[model samples]
Target: MACGRFKELMMASLDGEISAEDRAQLESHLAECADCRRELDELSELSELVGEIELPRPSQEDMMKYWPSVYAKIERGAGWGLLVIGVVVWVAYGVFLFITDPTTGSMTKFLIALPVVGALMLLVSVIRERVNTSKTERYKEVER
Candidate 1:
């Protein structure tokens, strides 16, 4: 059996949340897997260290103050989503109209569309690269 499978069991056991059957199973696995036993010990130590610290609870007034800020963040995200959808739809409609115009020659439309397509491809590539880099770039905090 993979050591990964016992990880959750180890946590449950540490928390005293495991059923008797699972606790027995975990103990049996721990007896055979030295690595898992070491992991569980480390987790036990860390959990104890964390358990020693206490965070202050927010007062009702503090929580009331937070509601508007949390709501604003959610509202802003929805607003941006709607704006992007509207812009993309409008641009696509404009492009379709321009491409289908009887006055515009096929060659001209093709020439005009080439740059737009290239620009979109470049934009998408940049966004993908940024996303990939952001996952590992721990120093770039977004606070402004």
Candidate 2:
């Protein structure tokens, strides 16, 4: 058997989960390959050490609170999204009025457009800064 195949069988053997035929092949490979034998021994020792570890369990109350906390976060995010959409629509309407009003002079229209354009530019800059900051944040890696 190839070294890779033997290594896979070695893991199965350590877990006592290999078929008789695979076990026989693995044993044969182990007898001839010193490197495979050493690796198998190291893996067996690591598995034994891991088996002795005891992980902490979460409390019942914490488990119960998890879903509601998640839901609240989702609700807040949705509320903010709706607020932004409403503000954008209101600004767009103001721009439309400034452009189409017959009595509004060109200078007056330009003055109104300046604030709208400046507000949009500021909004874009803030959003881009937030996106770049999030990209650098390492908290996402912990969730995985």
* TM-score per candidate: 0.57, 0.77
Report the lDDT tens digits of candidate 2 across residue range 1-144.
469878788889999999999988888888999999999989999999999999999999999999999999999999999999999999889878768999989998888779978998999999999999899987867865
Instruction: Please write out the lDDT profile of model 1 over residues 49-93, one tens digit for every residue.
Output: 999999999899988989898999999999999999999999989
Query: What is the alpha-carbon lDDT for the whole of candidate 1?
Result: 0.93
RMSD list, candidates in order: 7.3, 4.4
> Which candidate gets the maximum lDDT versus the true structure?
1
Angstrom error at residue 72, model 2: 0.5
Candidate 1 displacement at residue 50 in angstroms: 8.0
Clashing pairs in 2: none
lDDT of each: 0.93, 0.91
lDDT measured at residue 137 in model 1 versus the true structure, 0 to 100: 88
